[model samples]
Target: MIRTESLTKRFGPVVAVDSVSLHVREGDRYGFLGPNGSGKTTLVRMLLGLVYPTSGTIEVMGRRMPARAAEVLPEVGSLIEGPAAYPYLSGRRNLSLIDAIGSRDKRSARRARIENVLGQVGLAGVDERPVKAYSLGMRQRLGLAAALLREPRLLILDEPTNGLDPQGIREIRDLLTELNKAGTTVFLSSHLLSEVEQLCTRVGVVDRGKLVLEEELTALRAPTGRILVESPDADKITGILNGRLVSRAGEHIVVEHEDAAELNAWLVGEGMRIASITPERRSLEEVVLAATGPGADRLDR
Candidate 1:
């Protein structure tokens, strides 16, 4: 539910965001990927109306942004860079205060809404300890709870799993997936390629302040005319497809096959006991690397 046309932003003599047209569908889990100094933060700020663009247009939820921010932003949730809260206040108290700001909801229902969002973000039954005592992960969870406070229709998150162990990351991943399935459009900007590979349905890669790639994850990762086969009859299968075989490593074999299904059927008919067979596809990492150059963070002598 977000669209931009030739969106550009400048700072004095430098351009932070170049001419970039971006599209995010209503129910998509979109991954916005870029390296440091690639202008991801600038682009996100423009979308949130925190920074006005130098040229072009932005639309969120089918309405012009910044101009219609009051009408559109209430339905949009965001976590940028990281979360913020009163360090001395309890998490619950922090949420209560944030929830009360410009909230049209009834006072009596605020507590329930707060608790529900807390539970959703894995902060359920949290003690009343001041936020200063919470670990980084807890603070991140607290921030997420704040974002979910309004049951937003669109979520724009940056580095959402910044300070957590693998389990916590997985928990948040599952939570985001569930929200997307329930019709919340997610715009995730992350440096973690694996996380986006697993979570997002579509991807947009930016480099040098320009949009480099934008496409469905499936299409970007299409099969590469090769099949990986694991089988008990590796030797026998190798002999049967000698002309097409690319390599053999113990029970695993790589074959130059256009269709895994056809190769699988041919092996099955040959009385080969196959363990597993699937077409090889480029990883999201491979695709993104091919599309963009070195990150701006790298310094060469």
Candidate 2:
């Protein structure tokens, strides 16, 4: 439902996004991961027509972006940077205004839509409260409700879990899962690796103004092993596993060996009785850090 080809963006002499290409299919819960200043938000802005790209193309929902963005944007709902709402207005009123401006549905239809979305976001009872009185989590929920007001085909959320408590984060995560199950395509951008690990099926990692990696979360999380052995001769065991061992944490050893069974058999035959053995898997954070290279620290700039 979304595709980009060599999308580039620049500011003065610096490039924010360079030849970045990506694609997302229907019903995809796609995660866009990057460090700060990694151009994630800039790419999202271009997709939404808030910023024009310096070169290349963006196609969203079968329509070319920037060129046909006016026709395509109405089918997309986005929460960029953060939720922007009228502080003095009630939550319901804010949504009502959005519906009036963004949708052509009748007043009664809009009201019904507003109520349904408010309930979906868990804000039904508090819709009448002024937005200024709402907590950060509440505002985030309210923003999501507004995004759903038009029943958009694509939802673009940038850091939707920012400032949310554990309960609120879980709530939003569950809501997004439900939406994707119902056939809504979700394009999520966030700095939280754990959240992406839990919520996304596929992910794209960006760094230093370039696209670094894009792959299924499962592929990125391929199982690896970490063995912790308690032996009378810990140093001796470490020497035997020299090249295969990745690191050491006190008496425990973390290794990245291809044949765990062979290693175990060798250890046992060598008179080492293992007290405990634990396997470790690569996490989303680890995969991202590896793919982006050591220069990924530019994301913090």
Candidate 3:
């Protein structure tokens, strides 16, 4: 439930965010993607009211941002930049301190929230350990716990899995997916393409401070298969399947078709012995690069 109209932001002569429009529907696990210095975080900051936009409008959860921040942001949980926790304080104590700043403003319920978030982020038993003794992954989980302490309707996470191991990444991915399934609108900005490919249902791609593409991940990843079949009787098979998109490459016939089963069966019906059939489909990363062109760099931040 976020919409922007030609949203622009500038730092003196430098424009961090250009005229960009974006839409994120309710219940969408949306991925906000762009290469390094592409203004992804700048846009999110404007949406969160951490910074004011130079021009344009922003509506989040049906409320104009900054102007309605008090009404809209109370319902939102965000982890921008990174997690901050006192090194001397225990995880439980650190969360308790962070919970004090929650939108609910219920200092009386802080203890219960501390425990609830510690458990939610997989730090229930070890929450008493000092933050200084915690691993990087543990600190990341603590940051997430801080974000969830409010139990807001919207979650805005920028690089939620930054500096995490493979297992830690998967853990965070599963947690975000579970949260989205349970009705929390998730807006994630990540450098990991594979993570976005696996976790997001919709994606908005940005480049040069401009919004390039916004669409369902399913539509972007639709099945457009290239079937390559090898056989000793390649000539006969090519002749039978000859079309504008069908061609014979060496001893193999390559057909641009969706159904590999039907294509394979067509060749087998002619009493042709088939060696093997392979279906090649363009992946989400491929589609993204195709759309973004060469401006797409290694976004492994």
Q: Estimate each model's TM-score.
A: 0.92, 0.86, 0.86
Better of 1 and 2 by lDDT: 1
Tell me the tens digit of each residue's lDDT in model 1 across 1-301: 9999999999999999999999999999999998789999999989999999999999999999989999999999999989998999999999999999997888779999998999999999799999999999998899999989988999999899989889999999999999999989999899889999999999999998999999999999999999999998999999989699999899999999999999999999989999999999999999988998887889881
RMSD of each: 2.0, 3.2, 3.5
Query: Residue-wise lDDT of candidate 3 within 1-301, one digit each (tens)?
Result: 9999999999999888999999999999999988777899999999999999999999999999999998998789888878888998898888776666634656667888778888887788884667889887788888888889878789999998887889889988998899898899999999899999999999999887889899999888776678878899887776666573466777877778878888778768879888998776667778777767454355552
Pairs of colliding residues, candidate 1: none
lDDT for model 3, on a 0 to 1 scale?
Answer: 0.85
What ranking of all candidate models by TM-score puts the best one first? 1, 3, 2
Q: Name the regions of candidate 3 deviating beyond 4 angstroms.
A: 102-108, 228-254, 272-279, 293-301
- By lDDT, is 2 or 3 better? 2
* Leading candidate by TM-score: 1
- Model 1, backbone clash pairs (residues 3+ apart or across chains), number: 0
